[model samples]
Target: MRHRRSIDLMPREDAADDGATLELLPEWYVLVAKCGKCRHQGRIDRRLVANRRGWGVSLNSIGPALKCVRCGNREGNKLLLGRLPRD
Candidate 1:
């Protein structure tokens, strides 16, 4: 069975709108990725995401594509997009 992940942070169509609006998202995101098998979690910097345009791909598509550095597993890895705490 193929496992599909949903980019629930934003609708897939919404994310592909434009780079200018998408650029602002990285600033607001606390990118958290978790492995479904090992339950390992990692944080990704905004800068890393800012550089990748991934044209024709929505930001939602990027999260599920992340591989777990610890286990090198691609399947079952979940990406979480959370907002930074307001001061």
Candidate 2:
């Protein structure tokens, strides 16, 4: 079974009386994983890439990647990687 997930690559605004355009920066990429069989949705942080080297990899080599916690799907598991906007 395959599941579809919706990932928000935009910043979310909080409720405020001020009309100013507030830009919230996320520390990491937010990933939304959904189950196709049950339609269950879940979210995971993409910061895991930082620890890839496991020993001492330079921060420059670490790129942005997201994984699905629910479906065990990797960033390259499907074409969803390109769908995300570049920072």
Candidate 3:
């Protein structure tokens, strides 16, 4: 006899659009942080951020907490969702 396993395709309640935590983000998605002051954009690694700030941290709370490495802009930072390449 062969055993079949079921996978959960639904996202959790804590995993909303933006208010979700780093680990809640799907594998096909990536996190990007942009600076409003300097207009600089950078890609964020979910595992890295989660390791540094823990997995339970909210995405919204991360934006303002980060400083733009380019212009050193500490305000008006926003977190955006980016998609990974299918290939």
Among the numbered candidates, top lDDT falls to 3
Question: In model 3, which residue pairs have backbone atoms overlapping below 3 Å?
Answer: none
For 9-85, candidate 1 gives per-residue lDDT tens digits of 43233434444333545465566777777878788665565577443445566656778889988987766665665
User: How high a TM-score does candidate 2 get?
Assistant: 0.27
- Residue pairs clashing, model 2: 2-36, 3-35, 3-36
- In model 1, the worst 10-residue window by lDDT is 1-10
lDDT of each: 0.59, 0.33, 0.70
> Per-residue lDDT tens digits of candidate 3, residues 1-87?
222212222212223354567777678877778887998888878888888899989876887787898999999877766666669
Of candidate 3, the 10-residue stretch with the lowest lDDT total is: 2-11
Candidate 2: C-alpha RMSD to true structure equals 13.6
- Ordering by TM-score: 3, 1, 2
TM-score: the better of candidates 1 and 2:
1
Q: lDDT tens string, model 2, 1-87?
A: 222324443212121222321122133434344443344445433344334533243222222233445665544322111135557
Pick the TM-score winner: 3
